[model samples]
Target: MAELIDVLLFAFLLATAFYVLLSRDLLAVVMVAGIYSLLSAGMFLVMDAADVAFTEAAVGAGVSTLLLLIALTATGRWEKPAGHRVVPLLVVLATGATLVYGTLDLPPIGKPDNPPQVHVAPHYLERSGEEIGIPNVVTSVLASYRGFDTLGEVVVVFTAGLGVFLLIGGPRRRRGGEK
Candidate 1:
């Protein structure tokens, strides 16, 4: 059953990725990309990284797509063709190779016998509430260790709102009218 779910999820992610790549319509591509994020989040959850999956589901699949859609609306839909440029393709290939190489060093997913995660996490899980005074480990970790990142995210949101307001609420020019 789990295998079937994994296969379906993988199919969804790959299909959406293909749609994003092949679609000429920018809006459709953006929507497909959002679906890809959502599918990826689902995959992460299946792998038991629930916190990371939650973040991916919210920020990647929800907020970022909305922001991208709004920006696309503010700008234009048509993207320029890169038919003449081999550079971008080469860059993507190189980055993908680098990522694949990096992944070779990662601990195998869901290996209960893995030494690294087992060593530190059990202690953190057992004592985090006592140490941090928060019942939710995720909230405690984020509010403590990742406080700066959370603040930065808030600042970014504020800046984006400021930009949108400026774009939509610019001063009106009095042109040949008595007001």
Candidate 2:
């Protein structure tokens, strides 16, 4: 059942991605992108990463969709034609091939002797309660053990939000032409 769900979700994701790539209308593309984000969040949930799923749903589906809609309102809906596509297509293919090749180095999921589990995870599970005094192991790992990484993620999100706001938000009007 789980495998079936995963297959279905992945099929939907591929279909949505193709639609997004082919669609000329910006609004339709934005809607399809939102669907892709929601599907991604669902995949994360299936992998037992509720925190990541929540972030994906909120940032990818909610905030990103809203921002894209605002930007679309400012710009035209249909995409404009470009002079050349061959070079860009080649670059994209090369990048995709590189990414696929890189994934070949990853260890199988949930392997008992995985480096992370062997080295880092056990120490965190054993010491989190004592050192961090957190009742929940997950909370301790996220808040205390991996605090810098969590903070960096927050900073990146905040910076992206600020950039989007500056892009879509026009300058404020002055009353009575005052400086």
Q: Which pairs in model 2 have colliding backbones?
A: none
Q: Candidate 1 on 1-179: residue-level lDDT in tens? A: 88999999999988998888777788888888988999999988988879999989999999999989998998778776658668988999999999999999888877887885688667667888788888778777677756899899899989988998887666765542656
What is the TM-score (0 to 1) of candidate 2? 0.84
Span of ten consecutive residues with least summed lDDT in model 1: 169-178
Q: lDDT values of the candidates?
A: 0.85, 0.91
Predicted candidate 2, C-alpha RMSD: 3.1
Which structure among the candidates has the greatest lDDT? 2
Per-residue lDDT of candidate 2, residues 78-157 (tens digit):
99977889999999999999999998998998798988889988988888878999777877888888999989988998
Candidate 2: segments with Cα more than 4 A from true spot: 158-179
TM-score of candidate 1 on Cα atoms, chains taken together: 0.75
lDDT of 2: 0.91
Give me the displacement of residue 60 in model 2, in angstroms.
0.7
